[model samples]
Target: MLRHFAHPKRLTLVAVPLAVLVAVAVTPQVRGQQGAGAFESSDEVRAAIARAERASKRADRRAQSLERAAGQAEQEAEKIASQSAALAARIQETEAEIAVGKGQLQLIARQQRALDARLGERREPLIRLTGALQNFSRRPLVLSVFRPGSIRESMYLRAVLETTIPQVRGRTAALRAEIDKSRALRAEAEGVLRKLAEEEDRLSLRRTQLAAIETRKRLAARRRGGEADRQEERALAYAEQARDLDGLVDRIDAAGALRDELAELPGPILRPTRPSQARASGTTTRIPPSTSRTVRSPSGLRLPVDGRTLRGFGSVDSKGARSEGLLIRAGAGAQVVTPAPGRVAFSGPFRGYDRIVIIEHPNGWTSLITGLARSDVNVGDTLAEGAPLGVAPPDGGAIGFELRLGGRSANPLDHLSR
Candidate 1:
């Protein structure tokens, strides 16, 4: 009897120190690993391999995401480069056009200078005519062909004054108008050239920005790739761990096979029950209707929190049994309440459970309330559905409510009336 009882105590004693030692040893190696369990099932070991596997998986995912981003960036860079080339071509064309405009301006300036000289010559004629006209106004030209020299000179001068001065003035005005139009055209061409240069500069700047983006994308891809490789490794490690665990369990089963022999030979004997018999005798199998009132619903479940349901209850793709409960992510410090009327049978921490409450209803059904910040009700306390049990804190994780019938998991939503 002592040996049988003492084994568990001895194992506990050894296991506690062994776990502490392993923790101290593996702390540095597993510093960044997030989700792996602390110790192997049978005994504590440095299991840095688990950490490596987690790192590998994280790295792999990041690498994949980065690779996708990098590819997109590369495509964008190429597009920007092409646009930059086109802008460069346009700039070159504008430069050539500007050169041609300058040459035309020079030619136009020379023509304007020639026109100004002609106007000066015309001005002198007009001034002389004005003086002659004043003198002629006082005297008459002789009508006869053989007249006095002054009279004949006056007649010829009168003809030249009417025709030549008016012609010169009209020509000068036309030339001035043409010069003004040419000046406007030259200014417009310069403005267009300036605009084209500005556009080219913008494209050049865009190309530079795109290049930088490409660099960042490539770096991200590299990091992600590393992560991906790591994840693959982790998955492999988990497979190995699972295999090792199976082997260990098999060995334990074999070692414990001699339970009958041990019982016969020893002082205080404890007969080992078969797996099926042990399971049948387990007290948790079911609570009778007379003893428990909290029962599961027939169907139609509702969410506890106001937020949209993220996942359904029985997702076939799930690796394990579909979640037996509803997960409600409520606001921080939100009130947690009971979903049905029942007596609180169990309250406090259970294995793998945080603050918890178990309600036994009239129909022999039980509802498990888990992930509570505080459990207000104690064993034998009765609670009605929707009664405030406690306040849930943020990061309290989603409140989980599960229904069980005769100790078998059931969908809680099937029982909820609301």
Candidate 2:
């Protein structure tokens, strides 16, 4: 019997179960330390999840707000400018929805990866134990009793199995839970993908509508003759003569001041035929009030685009010069709009600034926006507050917006509506 128990095959049978028991016992302690480390790592993931959720919620709220604004603009649409503004708002709303979808997808992917890792860690020992148990079960109990020293070995094996099988079952149950979570994450990802697709479709449609409106505006401007063209030419000539961006702005402001002065001049007056008859009439000639009304400052100002402000007025820029404007990091093709009611003083490309729009507001307030893919409005076009100005570069670039009062830079944030 002792010799039978000493056989290599029988020893292997005993060693396999004992190895499984040792592995099952030691793995938990090692895994406990690993779990502590994992917990620390997971805390960071949780924080990321929280941030993603907050961003998603904010995007949702912004999308709803823009949608409402779009609807209102559409209802009030009487001109091509108002129609363009409505379409711009819709495009921005769609972009916000797309942002929410992307955040959700990132959150789902992180959760899925974590669950997959947990399941992988739990399955390794279970796989080895499964093979060993299968081989042991194939050996008949009656055959074990027939072999020398087999009865005692089988009984000892049964005792080991009784002690260890419950722990294995517990591990399997936990693995099942992780698998369910992984499946749920996949389903959530699919839903977010579908929503993202819908938002992209809406964005495409809104852009098409805006393009049509812009085409109509261009045709109308062409029918109005070459006055706008001559003004644009004059503005471009000024841009060529200016030394820098600020110089170009100062020249444009000077031109706007001249234009306003010319508009305020009174028309020709008629002379009376008879001085004696005029004295008897007792009627006096009255002059018109000044058309260029001045205000203390621009009011109800807001951001021209939805973006993160990277540099504020007075911040140092990459060129080692103090910034006189806001540099905003906006998404590709983001909508640009007027922060206050104004007339387009210059709308075209200038030296190294891409397409730009200069708006002259009441009370000597001027807004200069640079870095655009296209300019929709023409020179001398009167725009209401929140009217669509144009779009940002398609490749996702920074936009520069400078607000000047009497040719001096002011912090735009200070004047923004609360």
Candidate 1: Cα lDDT at 376: 51
Q: After superposition, how far is residue 233 of candidate 1 from its true place, in Å?
A: 46
Candidate 2 on 1-96: residue-level lDDT in tens? 545434455444445545544443333211221122322355554554454345345434544554555556643334456556656656765665
lDDT of 1 by residue, 5-121 (tens): 233433333333333333322322211121123232212212232332343343334334434444555565444333322322222233223333333333434443454455455
TM per candidate: 0.29, 0.73
Candidate no. 2 TM-score = 0.73
Model 1 regions more than 4 Å off: 1-305, 316-321
lDDT of 2 at 83: 59
Clashes of 2: 0
